[model samples]
Each structure stands twice: as C-alpha cells, then as structure tokens.
Target: MILLRNLVFALFFGIGSVVIVGLAPVSALFGQRAMIRHATAWTRFHHQLVRWVLGIRVAVEGERPSGPALYAAKHQAMWETLELQMRLDGAAMVLKRELADIPVWGWAALRYGAIPVDREASAAALRQMIKDARRARAQGRSVLIFPEGTRVAPGETPPLKPGFAGLYGALDMPCVPVATDSGRCWPRKGLKRPGVITLRYGAAVPPGLPRRDAEALIHAGINALERRA
Candidate 1:
C-alpha cells in the first residue's frame, strides 16, 4: 500500500509540475505578480497532494515572519521545500543552479524570482547570490534559504553552510530561523511515512551582529527542531 501510494503521488507530481511550468510564458505576459501567484498556487496544489494522497499533515508553530526578511531554515526533505510557500507568500527561495537548468521548470523559477547558486561553491558564486538576494528584497519578496545547503536525516545534525552567513551579512536584514521535523515523515530518500509535519519559526535574529554570532544563532535554532521532535 505504501509503495502504491508513493507511486500515485510521484505520477501526479511529475505531470502537475510540467503543467505548472508550461504556464511560464502566460505568467510572463502578466508580470511578476502573476508569476508569483502562479508559483504560490502550484505550491498549494502540492500541499494538497501530500495531504490527501500521502496522508501527511502539516502544522506551523510559533509566529510567521513578515515584511522583508531573510529566513534561514533547516533542510529536512523535499517536503519543506514546498512548505515554504505556506509559511511565506511569494517566497524567493535560494536553490541550486542545476534546478534552474531544467526546461520549463527552470524558466518558471527564474520568473518567480528564485535565487539559484552554483554547487561548486566559489567566491564569485557567493557574491552573485548576495546580489540576486538583495535584488529580490528590493522587489518586495521575502527570501528563504536552507542553512545546511542539503537535506539531512531527522537525528543527524550538520553545520550551517557558510553561504548562509554571507547572505545574512550582505543582505543585512533580520534573519528568521525556521526548524521542521518533516523528514521524519518524508525522508530525504526511500519510503514515505504518515504523520504530522511541524514547522517552527523562531524569533528573528536582527541585523548588525558579527558573523560568528549570527551563524551560531542560526545553527542552534535550526538544530533545536530535531531536539524538540
């Protein structure tokens, strides 16, 4: 039954994704707001798929960050990726460059104002990310980044990547650290389990702090999600 359920979701996800991406040209004709709306709608649809098909419920704890801010979050599974739109409307996510290279999906992501980074992790890449992130803020879209760069298992704890700190310092906006236990139900790989996924938003770490201090705060906050679970 689990395998059948997973397959059903996988098929729906693939087709639905392509359909959403195919709307890129039409969304462009209407402008940024249209693109953002389409992106948010797509995410909401995904939320329904997991809830109804896969039986995974979602709940958000603590306060939702508002206005222009940088959201540093824990990376658990693909679930949290889609769940971001639920937390923040029209969120400009920090993603990998490879995802931007896809056919229609990549183009739609660019139109939606997502910030893509190189996996090679160079000095120039970091600089470009900061530039794009600042531009996203100027456009009035909030930013969401996975401080760990990649997803990890529920109990495993990893150091927050340096790109997070660079963006925090360069953007100079209040950083809101988010933690989630989605991986317990939606693992980074393998079988899917059914349970409630909780996203906890911590207090904002305001700007003007030293790099080390900011990094420490984000790291501790994100890892705290695991401890709570």
Candidate 2:
C-alpha cells in the first residue's frame, strides 16, 4: 500500500514538476518575480502531493524567521529544502553548482534567484557565493543554506562546510539554525514513510561572532533535536 501510494505520488509529482519547468519560458517572459511565483506554486503542488498521497505532514516549532536573515538548516532529506523556502516566504537558496546545471530546471532555478556554489573551487566558490548572496540581500531576500553541504541520515551530525562561515561573515545577518526530523519520514533513498516531520527553529545567532563560535552555535542548534533523540 505504501509502495503504491509512493508510486502514485511520484508520478503526479514528476508530471507537475515537468509542467512547471515547461512553463518557465512563459514565466521568464513576465520577469523573475513571475518565475519565483511559479516556483512557489510548484512547491505548493509538491506539498499537497505529500499530504494527500503520501500521508506526510510538516509541523513547525518556534517562530519562523522574518525579514532579511540567514537560515542555516540541517540537511536530512529533500523535504526540508522545499519546505524551508515556503516557510520563509521566498528566500534566496544557496545550492550546489551541479543542481544549477540541470538544463531547464537549473535555468529556472537561477532565474528564480538561487545562488549556486562550486564546491571544488574552494576559496573562489566562497567569493562568488558571497557576491551572489550580497546581491540577494540587496534585493531584500533572506538567504537559506544547508550548512552541512549534503543530506545525511536522521542521526548523523556532520561538520558544516566552510562556505557557510564565509557567507555568514560576509552577509552580516542574524542566523536562524533550523533542525528537523525530516529524514525519519523522507529518506535520501527508498520510499518515503508517512509521519510528521517536525521543524524546530532555534534562537537566532547574532552576527559578528568569531567564525569558530558561530559554527559551534549553528552546529549545536541544527542538531538539537537529533541530539535529544
């Protein structure tokens, strides 16, 4: 039954995604705001599918960050990636270079204002990310980044990527560290299970702390829920 539900959800989800991406040209004709609206609608479609077909739901804890701030979230599954954007009411997502290279979808993401970083480029990538992030900030958008760089299992706690610190320091924005149990319901691979995925937003870490201090606070904050379990 779960398998059948997942298959159905995947089919609808895939079709919806293709349709949204297919309309990118039209959305682009209207400008970047239109493209972002299209992207948000696509995310809503995904959420509905997750709820109606997969029987999964999200429960957010604590106050959602407002205004221009840095959202540093734990990486567990693809679920939080979309959810965070919606909850933040449209943020400038910092993503990997490879994801931004995926033909039409990638082009649409760039049009919608995602900042892509090339991990292999190290220092250069950090510089480029800060530059892009500054542009996003100037445009009055909060920046959302998964500091861990890649998704991990529910219990795994990995050190954040160096780029996170660089961006944090450069952006000079208060950081909201978000923790989630998304992996419990949505695994990186295999069928997603039906359950409540709790997103717990920690207190905002003030900007301008030393790099080591900021990283430590963010690491502990994002792993707070996991640590208790």
C-alpha TM-score for every candidate: 0.95, 0.97
Question: What is the Cα-based lDDT of residue 137 in candidate 2?
Answer: 91
Q: Candidate 1 — worst ten consecutive residues by lDDT sum? A: 220-229
lDDT of 1: 0.87
Best by lDDT: 2
Q: What local lDDT does model 1 show for residue 196?
A: 93
Per-residue accuracy of model 2 over 1-229 as CA lDDT, tens digit each = 8999999998999998888889898998898788878888988888889998999988888886567899999989898888777778779999999999999999999999999999774887889899999998998999999999999998899999888999899999999999998999888889999989889999999999999999999999999989755
Predicted candidate 1 versus true structure: per-residue lDDT over 1-229, tens digit per residue: 8888899999998899888878777987899889988888888889999999999998877886558889998888988888786558877899999999998788888988889999877999999999999999898878999988998888778888889989998887899989889888888678887789888888889998999999998888877778765
Residue 120 local lDDT, model 2: 77
Candidate 2 lDDT for residue 35: 80
